[model samples]
Target: MDRKKFLKNGLLGLGTIVALPTAMNSCTKDDSIDATNDNATDGSNSSGSGDCTLSPSETAGPFPIKTPADLVRENIVGDRDGVAMLINITVQDQSEDCAPLAGVYVDLWHCDADGNYSEYGGTGMQSTNYTNVHFLRGRQTTDSNGQVSFISIFPGWYNGRAPHIHIEVLKTNGSSIRVTQIAFPKSICDTVYSTSAYKGTANMLNENDNVFSDSLEDNMADSVTGDTTNGYTLTKTIVV
Candidate 1:
């Protein structure tokens, strides 16, 4: 669909699922954009499946594995100075079959409220100096099936954009390529998305939003219960 028309006609689901090997943004970023990283090894391009039937939902997770929430201390883990947002992810194959892909590492990164990042032990993210700390970001291997979870807060909106987070799925084995940036629901995202800056970039129509126009289900819809009003959840299948 044409850009203008597409924005207006956006996918129109509560969640925006992205296609494989999809990049959520065309807006070049300098924070950190390397498809290749230390945690991943399988760098080939393929859907995340391998005759495997294990799904993340079914797989045991490295963390306590809790539902996503935004309330203070509702779903808490990690250190007091640094709270992690837990993400429950699932991976699937082409046949629409689902399974837990274990030994896989999931990476996450998101801005804190007031729109700032915590660099290491810095005073959260508003400090003038960009510390080398990576708060609200972590990596954990999926258990037997394909389930991995995180403990974190609902990210605030920033610079004319929607409330969302950045993620990457990889073979904890350090080889498979990665998929990043799934979107959240507008209705639930109202508070953050309503912020002044987000409105400037809010998708007047889904089709108009450059990122939403081209995303895969794995990135957008991470779980079977895509209709939940809680925090974010989506699934992706990776192949090595």
Candidate 2:
């Protein structure tokens, strides 16, 4: 869907970036974890039961297709080619004493390996009929663990921005609550781009990206593990 449709249907609307609170980097034990919870894995410090700092909001970037019939699935890559990646997102509610938020719908979408967005205009792509073909876009519902994971390809870079993934959290009734983007570490991005499929022009660093220039939002960076040859796992908590 286009930007008009997305805003009309409770998805993200075009607006100024929402910087993450600086205190999130130093969140104290008062924002502690719940003893009964066990959703964390792969060395993630974020837990579902803690009163986490609210994640910063971000622009939806003019390419989200948030219609009712777009289809929701765990594997968003389809047949797209690039290094494999696993994105693990944990959604926690800052309002409910930081309880694990279940049944929330998480929308994840990104460009392909060549920096071409699936349903958007790009070089060598059909700009006039971009919406007809949808790829690298999908949604997954958070389980009891407050986690929704997706299998996708490592995203590539384009002009004036860094490599990142857009994520939106919608309530059970389909109303959007939080909109944000996740960034990969520069070192990890370097390693991923070394592969032949991603060896094109490099992306701008986070400080150069307009949306990520705010220092407080640095927490948006993912905890990435693994390599280009064996695939990678990117994990982050979505505190809304």
Candidate 3:
């Protein structure tokens, strides 16, 4: 079977479970957390069982700059300002018996807190010009434990779309094995949007998003606990 077709088909069933490590589970507490400062030992890779499903694949959207070769760092928040956010992603090869996919390249990019994507067209929320601003976009290689994390801000909302982040998983040779978008819990979005830093006021829901609506159960990201006040840590396990 083609790798791309297999991934899409596998996600249609009960295969997209995002397991969190015990260490990164501190968000359950209501106290404030320093997500950026704790980057050394923040997220954990490998879910005990490899039986979990892969994250559902979705469109890369209208703004995607940089290629696999451009990935040089783990921290993609290049001068963007907003509430702190930590994205913890684990990639495993389901085709290879759910083995940890070490050395895999994971690309993550999203819009800024103002609902604008850098280096892309800005039509509705702002001007119709493209800028060299490349915040909230970065790449990281999976470790021996099949884990890669990014330090960013809770994504802002925009028209015709829900609060989400785009991720592309590729092999060491830069061949894309999986492409998908991670959706945020609506409750979290509401809480984050209430803050002053995030001024974008688009109220689109997961059920309304065209791509996510078809696979809401499998596409919706696992529930996260932290808020904008304490910063957020989103953990997900992706089986490719």
| Predicted candidate 1 versus true structure: per-residue lDDT over 150-169, tens digit per residue | 55545554444444565555
Compared with the true structure, what per-residue lDDT tens digits does model 3 show for residues 67-116?
A: 54665565566766677666778898876777789998888898988878
lDDT of 2 by residue, 1-240 (tens): 132332223212211111211212322222112122121112222233324766666778867765624658766776667877667788988888767899999998888887777766643542444555677888888988798777677898777778889889998788898877887666667777887888565658765666665522434443566666656667788888
Better of 1 and 2 by lDDT: 2
Clashing pairs in 3: 15-53, 16-53
Per-candidate RMSD, Å: 13.5, 12.8, 13.1
Model 3, residue 45: displacement in angstroms? 26
Write down the lDDT of every candidate, Cα atoms only: 0.38, 0.65, 0.65
The prediction achieving the highest TM-score against the true structure is 3
Off by over 4 Å in 2: 1-51, 66-69, 122-130, 215-219
Against the true structure, candidate 3 reaches a TM-score of: 0.75
Order of all candidates by lDDT, from best down to worst? 3, 2, 1
lDDT of 1: 0.38
Among all windows of 10 consecutive residues in model 2, the one with the lowest summed lDDT is: 11-20
